[model samples]
Target: MLTGQQYKDSLKDGRKVYFQGELIEDLETVPALAAPLNEVASGYDKYFNADPDAINPVTMAPMSAADLRDRIPVITEMDLLTNTTYQSLMTLSVAAARLEAHVPEVVPRIRAYVEQARKDDIRITECITDAKGNRSLAPSKQEDPDSYVRVVERRPDGVVIRGAKLHISAAAFGHDLMVMPTKAMKPGEEDYSIAACIPANSPGVHMTNTTYHPTGRDPRDFPVSSHRSIPDSMVIFDDVFVPAERIFLDGQTAHAAVFAHSLGLWERLGGVSFMVEQADELVGLASLIAEANGTAKISHVREKIDEMMIHATLLRAGLEAALAHANSTPEGYFYPDDMYTNVTKYQGASQFNTMVKHLHDIAGGAVVTAPSMLDFDNPELRPYLEKYMSTGSTVSGEYRTKLFHAIRDTTADSFGGWHFVTNLQSGGGLFAQRLVTRKNYDLERARALALKAAGLSGA
Candidate 1:
């Protein structure tokens, strides 16, 4: 396994990464990329350096309910790249199993790839969302056929693909890119049904990156995001070649959706797990700020805290159910229950804004308009501001202001905006979650129960 320093050194392998229109020659030197890079590097040193004889829990296949349950805390604490790497491996495992009966030839290839990735201990980021030129049209019907990544040439050794994937997180930093079909494909759309694992530094691959890390601000003022932020990339493949061994799916339109659905299942499981953690964190923030504001004893403030506590509990219950009812593949790899995972993800995402709203209502305008920490450093102004800002002896002005800073940094600023959108859009949007929930729901059982409730049973 690579160490933290080794991981940072490996990115010097000539990957083309751009930030703010300037090609970044070294990611470690870029201010915006430094925090996330360090985050992944630290994760490698922390998790992958255990005893060589023991199985690395991050990549281990869950064999039972306890195994699945045990992964929750790790998943919640994992960095973005590490978590995505887990999702990538699990997606391949699930897809390979689903394809065993239909396309047995790909099974061994996938298993081999997974094993090699584990041995190498390299980070991988998934590239699934396409440029998707027109939302109303299919891949082949778009004005630019390259809107969706597709195979343009098939050589004896490999295939060449051309297109772009949008909103790929940490694409510029990972060692490999897991490319797959964004949606199901029809018969004539075989060229677009391509899935492969390509090197991040492969020729013709380029990434334009963007991040939410605060620029030119006091780190204390932006505590939550200043310490960590993942960069999203527009990963472009300009006729990138994929060796035969690296290609997991090619021209198999029938099984294209299998990769997408498989990825969705794992991704949503991770999303739901993170949501459970974030829900609790938000509750803690709400409670802490209320106390600092001396509103903890107010009935309405207590009610709002009560509501947030319930939200956190429900989300936790959903995650528990997903693990307890885990489903196993034919090969004995266990995954979270799809119905519970999707339903919980949907409920958490749909209600996220409302939860934030409740937090904001309790926090008041100070969340956005709070004085900067630097102001407290001013010798002359500090005394006056402290005198007015403090509620009593227990709550100093700086103490209360720090809580406001946390709230603003997490929910009212750039990082907050990123959280809001990602909470809804990541692991597919709320619509996608709804579709999966509907598909997995036991409607037949519900119908039977309804019939029994009415007087129409056996009629």
Candidate 2:
């Protein structure tokens, strides 16, 4: 619901953070992180602000003055399509906001500003994870004072925050960032139990430029990792202001995860949906690579491609099942099936890794050691690399190498490095998904069915 501009202006006040030992003054205007920030802003613009008809559909029947203000949007296209998009983005925005809130440089006040956003628009990002420095020691057990962002000042108008937030995305360019306990906060750890929205350009804020891929590779031989990116960062918040209105539940350790889980349904569904769409592309891309290399006719390649297709299709079916069996909650939101979403996510994560590896197998060693496309154009080596690199007939050997290199950049180094890691970390870990699935198991229903089949209970 929040526009890109509204999101931008809200972050005037600075929050505290450290990156490379220096503070980031203007996050939105920064060069390295600017594109992704703008990408998120542009996505927001497509929502209720400009393309309501495309996103949210409503009847435009002729009515008196009383009805003019009440209409949400007119149903220009089919109502189903409109609702479908809005719901899809509703899920996406939830995820986006969660992603935005983590970077210290993005939002001014982490909590108060976001409450204002709820009244105004969809300004949500995941302050999902802390640096988790050791991955061995827990949040409360971290070594550094700045390891986990904590409250340092509680003013009359707002609470001041200190420490750093980590591995947050779009926080450098979001209107509001959602800050919450990275994991469940305990009673003794209430200081870390927070779920608030803050503006992007807050005072005392800072962010570091962290990338695990070819973030800015050029197009001539553009690296593939640069194309399909999932950005992540560690945000530091040092004594930042979070006004009262923006505070949802501070130090309520019991409810920290609950508050986070409350808004999670839309995002979980959103994650599943994005992976489903991307999986389709991944499968297609794999097929194209196989075909381009003449291995399309091979039975092993065919089976591998089939496996990718099956995984992708099952993910789609999972999304539909979640949608079909959605349940309403007191929060006025509809939640999709957690089991199905988790199943889709778990399989999707593992399958994506598998698909990339299979692609490498089909692509041969050239997927990694292939000469850079730039080398092909070099007068000295151009003829040589191209002369020997041919794999099939259609596109030149250089072209084939280009395609395979793209795959390598993605599959080679951690699936686009930070991006793949970000996806794994996005909606909690794969382990977390397994736990949720276990919690959602309908054991009583299974027991009842078993008893009925055994004639121990009435049918």
Candidate 3:
């Protein structure tokens, strides 16, 4: 990873891409991209450079080695599927043991870029998810349009890109981008399968930004919602040129799949790690809310809290499982098991939804109707809301505030309220997980076992 200064310098690599109508350059000054750079910068300094090396000295080198690159993106997409499935299972078990060591390597590289961008005030984002045209069809089979991003022309030193990458988070806010395959591409989808990092200003690259308002971003500043609300952009790359060094995968469908799967495994682990913590936070809030509502001692409500606690435990178990069993590949760094990682994510999805539902259930209608703190602070409504919202028990004013604010944020803002939707969708969405899961699991063996016991059929 480059230093913060170097990272900022790297953002200036001359690349042309269309944004709006005219070409834009030097993203540091882009008005629309300022806040995001700020947010990313804050995350980097605190998280990335916390260690002496500004990277994880203990585990980074071992984890950040070029080993993962050795897994060719050109491998058969079919094989990539198997490896992804396997890796997911392994990672879910003990994600921390395997991944924590590498944070030094991963964080600094990502952080350095983000930090410098923060310092220079340049915009940058990553694009991986494809337009994926028709849900039922593959990237190559989409009708009437380009559902997936692909290469349109091949230059000796670079390649021209076309099509759109959908649901690309932070697209509009970036000055340059790192694009890669969202999933394995099928044969004949070679153009779409090429993966590379290109400038956001690459020729013909356009972004349709989204806003997940209310809870997403700072709503006072952004107001769109649901695929909107300034969430992401539909990155349209039209004949954009990508030089070779910036190219990570080119028509190497097989290797692309491996790379994607590997990334997916790690992403699943990390995502679950964060999501689990989020759920725990909600659960803790729920308890406080219950106490304020004079329902803390209720048997059923306590039971729900217990269930929520179990979710955290299970989530940690999966994370630890992934880490405990991780191994290093020729790529030098480590990758977790597919089965455990997927299981962690899968279970997480199910449990998180379940947990949230209980939160809504326990919270009654109050979660949605609680008085805003602002309103409660008002002179007139303060008396009324504080009186009505309060349980009139032994709860203090501070305790009541804590309870009300808990539900308010969970159901309020895009970032705060839509956590479930984001978690379910961000990591390839729920159904996509199922698609990989079915491919990864050995259904035949299970079927054989059932048949043997029933004497109906056998291999």
Name the candidate that leads on lDDT: 1
**What ranges in model 2 sit over 4 Å off?**
1-31, 41-124, 131-148, 183-189, 213-216, 223-230, 379-385, 445-459
lDDT of 2 at 314: 93
lDDT at position 309, candidate 3: 86
lDDT of residue 96 for candidate 1? 92
* Residues 1-459, model 2: lDDT tens digits: 556666455544564423345665555544444444454455455554453323212211213323322222221112222222333234333433443444323233433343333445543445656766777776677786456667666778768877767766545444455676666767677777766656645666666646443444544343644433334556667667987766655675665565456446645655676678778867876888888778898999999889888888998888777666666543234567778878888878766777767767777777667787678768999877776777645667777777876676656664455446655866777888889888998988999999988999875
Candidate 3 Cα misplacement greater than 4 A, ranges: 1-35, 47-124, 173-175, 213-230, 435-459
* Cα TM-score of candidate 1: 0.96
As a whole number from 0 to 100, the lDDT of residue 351 in candidate 1 is 88
What C-alpha lDDT values do all the predictions have? 0.90, 0.59, 0.57
On TM-score, the candidate that comes out on top is 1
lDDT of 1 by residue, 64-152 (tens): 77888888888888898999998899889889989999989988999999988988888899999999999999999999999999999
Between prediction 1 and prediction 3, which has the larger lDDT? 1
TM-score of 2: 0.74
